[model samples]
Target: MPTVAQIEQALFQLAPKDLAFDWDNVGHLEGSPDQEVQRVLVALDVTENVVSEAEKLGCQLIVSHHPLMNVRWHQAEMQTLRPDRYLGRLLRRLVKADISVISMHTNLDIAPGGVNDALAEALRIEDPGPMPGDETGLCRVGRLRNPVKLSDFAGEVCKALHANGVRYAGDRPVEYIAVGGGACGDEIDAVIAAGCDTFVTSDLTYHQFLDAAPKGINLIDAGHFPTEDPVCAKIVAYLEKEFPQLIIIKSTSHKEVIQYFVEGE
Candidate 1:
């Protein structure tokens, strides 16, 4: 069995720590590094349910896209653990279960074959590359195999990402495309600068859609969880290959929490 530190090392290679934004947290955030791990669970977020699932599965470690603890929580002043709070409750559960946590946040988003790339592949974007003029490289620019109407492409995105529904703007045909998994709606300017006629991402504000429509760019807000969840499978596959002797599973109990409703349904 591999130690938690060993698995963390492998993950660091997959998404180097330096690639992570300075303000973002990544790598091993909880539990003993030297703890041996025979089974691991992967999930997009380390929620209460995910922690419970890890306990039930006998997983020694959980590898997640989002950090279990926020950057502010790492402060010495915030170190007082209170079980009443959400993060505090989850932390207590994890500590009791002896489940370690490793987060691959913005680094995973910027890494090759990571979140953005996985999303592009899901949408069938051809020849995906780093978004131009975006130093963070949190987004990917590419072209679809063929041009399609914005409405048609939105449908494809919803289906591809398993989104309950998608909110979109613009009526132009989509060909060149850009993708940013999670709350990357702010990158619309970079998407336009990259010459992408369509931008597929999540967590957009109404103002963003309003601003984008007149700019002749198609924007699809596919929901944050849907956009980033594809990378969980990628993580599972990578870890399985790296540690063939260990059991690595994507969390079956964790999933998109949001649902959509239509009138008279």
Candidate 2:
């Protein structure tokens, strides 16, 4: 069985710590580095439900996309860990269960076959390449295999991502496209400048949709979890290949936490 540190090292080869943003948290966040691992649970987020699932599956470690500790918790003043709060409660559960955690955040988003690449592939973007003028390289640009009405393309995105629903804007067809996995509404300007007629991302503000139609860009606001969750499977496959002796399972209990409803439903 590999130690926690060894598994982390293997993960780093997939998405290095140096690739993470300075402000973001990545790598092993908790538990003993030397602890041996046989079963690992992979998840998009380390929620209470995910932790419980890890315990039930007899997992010795959890690999997640988002950090167990929020970036806000990295501040010096926030060092005092309280068991009463939400984050505290989750941390307590992990500590008690002896489950080690490793996270790949911004680094995963920026890696070659990471979040954005998976999103582009999910949406069927052809010949995908890096978004032009994006210094962070957090987004991808490409042409759709065939042009379709914005409404039609949005349906495809929903189906591809298993999204509960999608909100979109713009009257034009979707052809050239750009994709950023989560909370990338701010990249619309770059999308337009890169000559992409469609942008697929999540966590858009109301104003972004209002402004998109006039700019001649189709904007699809897929839910945040849907946009990023696909990468969990990618991580699972990578780990399974790298550590053939270990048992790797993607958390079946984890899914989009938010529920959507239609007016007539």
Candidate 3:
């Protein structure tokens, strides 16, 4: 079995926390480095359900996309609005149960062949290139070598990712396209300059969609978790290769924040 420190170094080399913004908390947030790895769990978010699921699966470590450690906690009130309260509780449970927490968010995004690359491959975008100003090197500029109808593209995304649904902006026939792993509305100019006629990502403001439409670029609002969750397997695959003895488990919790259907009348 690999030691926690060794596995950690492997993950860090793949996604250095320094690649992330100073404010974005990432890397190992719980447990000692020297701890022996028994089993590992990977997730898009570190939630209480995830913690419990890991506990049940006999996973002693959790690798998540979003950090439970993001933002400082000057308050101990344990309120719902508290940034870390809920996740803190989950971590506490893990700590109590001897489970460790690790995350790769922006850091993973910035890593070479990281989240965006994974997404691009999944989306089958051709002629992939790196995002501009990515001195740390996150977000790739890519094009679809073959055109896909806008709805067909969305449907393909759902099939490829096993997503519940996908949202979009623009009409049929996407000649050129841009795809960022999670919510990446700020990359509009880069997408335009990259000569993409359409963009696919999570979380699009209606106004931003409206603005992009005029520019002749289509926007797709795939759900955040759906867009990101598939990459959990990538982390597991990396770990499985790096440390053969280290057992890495996919997160069992389908903790979707958004519901697809409303209450029946």
lDDT of 2 at 208: 93
Clashes of 1: 0
On lDDT, who's better, 2 or 3? 2
Can you tell me which runs of candidate 2 are displaced by over 4 Å?
73-77
lDDT of each residue in 1-265, candidate 3, tens digit only? 6766777789998988678877787877788777788899898887788888988988878888987665554234434443356655665687788888888888887676678778878888787777655444656766677887888888888788767777777864786666677878888777777677878788888898778667878888777877777678789899998988878888777555776653572
Question: Which ten contiguous residues of candidate 2 have the minimum total lDDT?
Answer: 71-80
Using TM-score as the yardstick, the better of models 1 and 3 is 1
* Reference-based TM-score, model 3: 0.88
User: What would the TM-score be for candidate 2 when compared with the true structure?
Assistant: 0.96
RMSD to true structure for each model, in Å: 1.5, 1.5, 3.2
Backbone clashes for every candidate come to: 0, 0, 1
What is the C-alpha lDDT profile of model 1 across 186-250, one tens digit per residue? 78988898888989999999888988878878899999999999999999999999999999999
Candidate 2 residue pairs in backbone clash: none
